[model samples]
Target: MSQTRFRARTRIVFSLLALSVMAAPAAAQTIVSTYTPLDLENCRHTAGKAEEDSGVWRCAGFGGIPVHVTANDMRMYVSYGGNAKNEPAARETLASFHGEGTSIEWRSERAANGKLKPFATILRFRTSVADGDKTVPGQVLVVTRLAPGPVCRVGYVDGRANPDANALARKIADERARNFRCGTDKAVVEGATGPGFSPPAE
Candidate 1:
């Protein structure tokens, strides 16, 4: 190749490298931060209407995905990571899930260790495609904890937080919401809605 052409190509390559380096920091900030960390803070005091408690801990949909809270003095909800559609699917799968748990499996793949907390259990679990899905991506690692009774759940959600972990977290949050049912204990957790929760301040 011509020396001049080679020089120009080298310049382009160096420019791209520089741009990539610059972009990495910003990308990391947003993607590597907490999952709805804001919710964790706000759930300290925020009231949602009669929340449609989805599942798990049952908080009446008071907490969004990956939300940490001592909401209504009920269980804190935290999602593994991911968008809304992620959780419902997992619930369905788990409901009829004759196979192994996708999230637990993925987490185990990258797990170097695990720890337990009060109402919170942190373990290395898969958050991505299952073992048989060859077309899917690699395994994911997720660590999470759930605190029962008017506690705040706070944690970092790496950009690549596991899909299963994300979905499962949502499932847990939904359950927690229902449990917080302000008026009745039929489907309630300690600090949640039943008689325990007081609608948080706006």
Candidate 2:
């Protein structure tokens, strides 16, 4: 074959290879989840009085990240980044009676380098619902954002109303938690909500 023809064919083959490399889809990010038990009984009391007690507890999180759990007035608040002071202001639901569960679910994104960066948390809360002459028990899954600022509740799924509350909460955390803007983005509430289950004002 002529040298001119061979060189021209080689350039065309290289161009095609470059185009295929550029057109290939990027790898999808993997999501990982880990759970830690919250033992308030073992936590160190920080402040408050009697029934209005407050305290902070440290729990293990994904990738050796420190998880801080703060309890105040029967409500639970959480923060990440190893600093309890990074905890956002209390933004509880309008419920009159509510308390958090003993476990926390951390949802993180796994990077190409095998690093797990937490982006959201799923915590269970038991609330009361007034039904006629008696009060009934109700459960809610609170999805909290972990980064881009102080941790804050980003979404909620009423367990009594949604049978797949856990899946829904995880979905919300994966989709909305990363970019949730504290005090600006209003938390989303799904399924049947009681009079006291209203989301706090942004």
Best by lDDT: 2
Native-vs-model 1 lDDT? Answer: 0.29
The prediction achieving the highest TM-score against the true structure is 2
| Model 2 TM | 0.72
Q: Rate the local accuracy (lDDT) of all candidates.
A: 0.29, 0.72
* lDDT (tens digit, per residue) of candidate 2 on 1-34: 9999999999999999998777664444378788
Please give each candidate's TM-score.
0.22, 0.72
lDDT of 1 at 125: 20
Model 1 ranges off by over 4 Å: 30-144, 147-202
Runs in model 2 with CA error above 4 Å? Answer: 1-29, 54-60, 89-94, 192-202
